[model samples]
Target: MLRDRDNVFCFTANNLDNSLSRLTFNSCTASSIPSSTLQTPPPITYTQPGLYNVYFVSDEGLPTMQVDCKQIRVLPQPIIEINNDTLICQRDTILLVANGPNLYSALWSPVHNTIPPFDTTSIRVHPQEDYRYNVHLEFTQGGGCAYDTSVLIRVSKVFADAGPDRFVADGAYTILGGPRMSMGQEYSYVWTPPTYLSSIVKPNPTSRPLDVMAYYVTVTNDSTGCFHSDSVWVRTECTEIHLPNAFNPVSDVAVNRNFGLLNNNVVKLEYFKIFNRWGQVVFETTDTGKKWDGTQNNIELPPDNYVWIIDGYCVNGKRIKKQGTVLLTR
Candidate 1:
């Protein structure tokens, strides 16, 4: 009689007499075996772990029969357990663990950015994109058994682009456009240097900066907590030119009554001219520092509205022209 751990078992009988007519066997195990006329019995498999009894009978056709009985025991197979699958952001790491009894060796298939020497029960893995990892376990010393399992990990990529740099007039209010990004409706936007912005939390905000400045926006994934940032330069241009409405030549020695450029951006004055009500030129000058003192050829003009036109160039080499009516008072 013999006991074994494996589920399948084979039995054989030997005798000197070769005239054996028939042979039959019966077992109390969960499965049944086929009858055989030869000396070897067919193999049988047991489903459950337990003790089993077998009875055998042989007939020689001479009114004589031989019978034998035996008892055998079977053991259960080893069990394997592994962790469940998961999802993570790009460039992130995750741990994989496997559990088993009397484990001789373990291996992970489809090699990736894993910690070196992946024979241990636990390992750290870094996958660039989505991947599936397989774990093969073996038990050789005590009981020869092998098992196979796999786990899937999904990697999501987060990216953001804040469009391009923009140019606007100085001290002017304009709408700042937002960036084009992926993973729509799953991200939040925030603008930095919120002092001159109409809204800080919105993707597109209004800005009115007094000088040249740079702005930045950060985009974050709400579910994964992944963030990316980009900047948009708010380049300011010297496009503003202010003109005075009225000036006084008499009793105003301290203040110049000249109708000249009032902005600090003008670098050179191309031409300046004054026109009366009948479209006749009264005063004209090509010098930027020269002023119209409400006089024509050194004569005090009357207190009436007069049209003035000024053409100049800014420090940035941009052409500028301004026309307005100024009131003169004696």
Candidate 2:
């Protein structure tokens, strides 16, 4: 029912003399002044929706009477109200849901595109700058008797950078979100793998990995939820390779028997070399995954001591070098 404004109607009685007529009119509503005793019952104002039968009766009261009746129809107009929404780390698409009809307009050119078309009560729009749609919903259901209602929708715009791909030292923590996470404020955020992040919802989070595997992050929006997302990679860089104090070079165990750096990945390896006590270079290699088997020219060297030196870089060209001794056991 449209109680927004009054539906008014006016009329004029021609060739009717007030001196010869005792005119009476009925407004056909219980709430309205039911009847008026004037020849031209000052314009009628109806506030409700429905069919109304207005009457104009002129009685001379002396065997003479005249009556006229007219019927008017009132139908409710469509109503639409849209609220302003916020986004950053911003949304690429948004859905506008409301009620109305006759939305033929060009006002949606700036907000986004219509996907899957649109119905009388809803529309889907895509990634765009910004927009304020002022449209009218006119209903002809009342046979050209329905009114038009105006609606305004303010679609906010926001942009985001998930930060840059970074390399952090193993067993150490680094903060995410390079420079800025968003261009605007007044919103919350979340990072994947809450297990590694110090605070998932914080703009910046500390990430620390303890093992040798890479962790992947994924984000999703719920059915009725709207949001935006981006991606970045964080890798572990091991500058200092691990070593054992001693190794059984001829032992049945492979990893436990190899006299070489324990790992080779992520970190940039420059050179790795091992020398005997007498300053004789027994093994040297710039290639990764190469290990010495306590052999000198294919002859297995007996129990002895060896010195090793390695040069490498990690975390953006930070130089690192180390030298140590390993006991080659029998």
For each candidate in turn, the TM-score is 0.51, 0.38
Backbone clashes in candidate 1 total 0
Off by over 4 Å in 1: 1-81, 113-115, 164-180, 195-199, 204-214, 224-226, 230-330
Model 1 Cα shift for residue 13 (angstroms)? 18
Best by TM-score: 1
Model 2 alpha-carbon miss at residue 317, Å: 13
Q: Candidate 1 local accuracy as lDDT? A: 0.72
Angstrom error at residue 242, model 2? 14
Model 2, 197-220: lDDT tens digits are 677776666776544333333233
Candidate 2 lands at a TM-score of: 0.38
Q: List the residue pairs that clash in candidate 2.
A: none
lDDT of 1 by residue, 55-90 (tens): 666555545666676665544556777778788877
Stretches off by above 4 angstroms in model 2 are 1-6, 9-27, 30-45, 48-71, 75-122, 126-142, 147-162, 167-173, 178-203, 207-229, 235-330
Q: Candidate 2 at residue 12, lDDT? A: 42
Q: For candidate 2, which ten residues in a row score worst on lDDT?
A: 215-224
Q: lDDT of each structure? A: 0.72, 0.57
lDDT score, candidate 2 = 0.57
